[model samples]
Target: MKHIIPYIAIILLATVIIYSNAEKERTRITERCQDTFSDAIRTEKKLLIKQFCMQYRQENSPNSLSVEDKKDWYDQNYLIATSPSRHQLDSLFRDGAHKINRNISTAIGYTFNGKNYFSGDESCRKSVIPVQECVYRKDTISTTDIALQAYIHIPFYVPLQNTYTYAVVLMASVALAVCFLYTRRRKKNMTGIPLQELPETGNVTPVIPRKVQTEKWMKLTDGYQWNPQNHMIEHAGKTVILRGEALRFFQKFIVDKHFFLSYSEICRLYHLKEETNGAKDRAYHSIKQLKDNVAELGIEIKSIRGKGYKLLFSHRNRQII
Candidate 1:
């Protein structure tokens, strides 16, 4: 459990980064859509106005009119030509805007010749659209007399409907793969006979051969030797004196022939008051020092956290003598 925390944290961090980048890319795409659509609309308006002015000039024969009258005629014609009805604008948006960009969802609106027109559906017009990364573009259709305003809303990029499903499947696959590997590694590490399997009866101890007991030196499975009489432990050909509270704490394993010992039991054995300030800290320090001292012996003291400690030796029962 402790080993998997870092992996989970890394996966979470990667997910955050991926999501942030996706949003940024979506914003960039929306901005590009705004620029593209704005230009398209402006171009279309210009062409329509040019065509209207040509038709008006041909039909009205402005050469017979005064300067102010000619200005009024041009203005009225421009307004009449550019200000299409709401239905016409809606049809234009439905037919034209959707083809402009495949990634962006668009809505268009206009206030033309004192009339309002919208290209969005009823729900879109009524509901408040959240503006995160929303792109808005407005253009003015102007003649010498009047101007009509046109606006467009380009929403952030939305991926295909299947994208979310694929992402979920991919993430689940990765998590399952990590969990599978961790379980396999844990199972592999447990192949040897566990040192915790001592007899539960307090009166019996596991038998050690006569050669081991008579030699005055007991050899652990991993090649460490302990001499109880001399109070010395040797590991990897180096010997360290084992004494004081640490020695007493370790001696509990021999006395009980058990792997687990609670903190209260160790404190009682070592005559340390458990309620005293820094008592547990001192005990932890002693355990750490003991661990460092015995590292080369292939023996480990694992703290069970909120419980107690367990001793583990690397090899199986073959070298218990």
Candidate 2:
């Protein structure tokens, strides 16, 4: 669980980065399309103007129309040839331009002759380009103007279903590899012998007879004796009855010899809380009573002030048992 959290965070970070980059690319493409469409509209208008001028000149060459009349004719012809009504442009964009780039849809709008004309999807206005105003001029005289506004709508791309599956498989592989290596390392550190392959033979026990001697009593000093089986201590020919916490505390001193037993060790052995009410006082009282009980046997329990407690005894007084 601890190891999986970091991997999950990494996967999330990667997903965010991928999505951000994809959105940026989509925006860039939309902007490029808008610029291209604006140029196309300007180019188309210029062509229509040139064509109308040539036709007008040819038709009126014999009678020779006035300049104002030519300008009016040019405006009318240019508007008719180049400027489709909003409805017509909308239909064209929906059915024609939309098919050109399936990934990116487009919308077009025109302000021609002081009337607004718009075409294509209404929802695709987010990436609208600035209106490109194209003026029709002949010999330095302004005939008319048309404004083209274009919008390129690029939908965000999402990864296919296989992408998620691949990511899951990758994370699982990493987790399994880490777990396998950890288990191998742990097993390598273990100490053991295989018992299943032991040789089958008779006389597995030692053949030579050996003498075994057991001590019946353990002596702390010349006048003190301890009976392990009975759990009794005799001092100066008097048996001292010690039980429960006292007996456990005395057994620690016996086992550890002169080594200090810290207050924490004492608390753990006695199942006592170090921070409980009067816990230290209770421990001190118990030690005082134990010292009194074993005083006649030349044994003493000494406190090392803020450190711990230790049993004071001469090593030469140790019994065989």
Task: Tell me the TM-score of model 2.
Answer: 0.34
* Total clashing pairs in model 2: 0
Worst 10 residues of 2 by lDDT: 131-140
Which residue pairs clash within candidate 1? none
Clashes of each: 0, 0
List candidate 1 stretches off by more than 4 Å. 1-7, 51-82, 86-103, 112-116, 126-157, 160-179, 190-321
Best model number under lDDT: 2
Give the alpha carbon lDDT tens digit for every residue of 126-166 in model 2. 55543222233233222244444555555445222235545
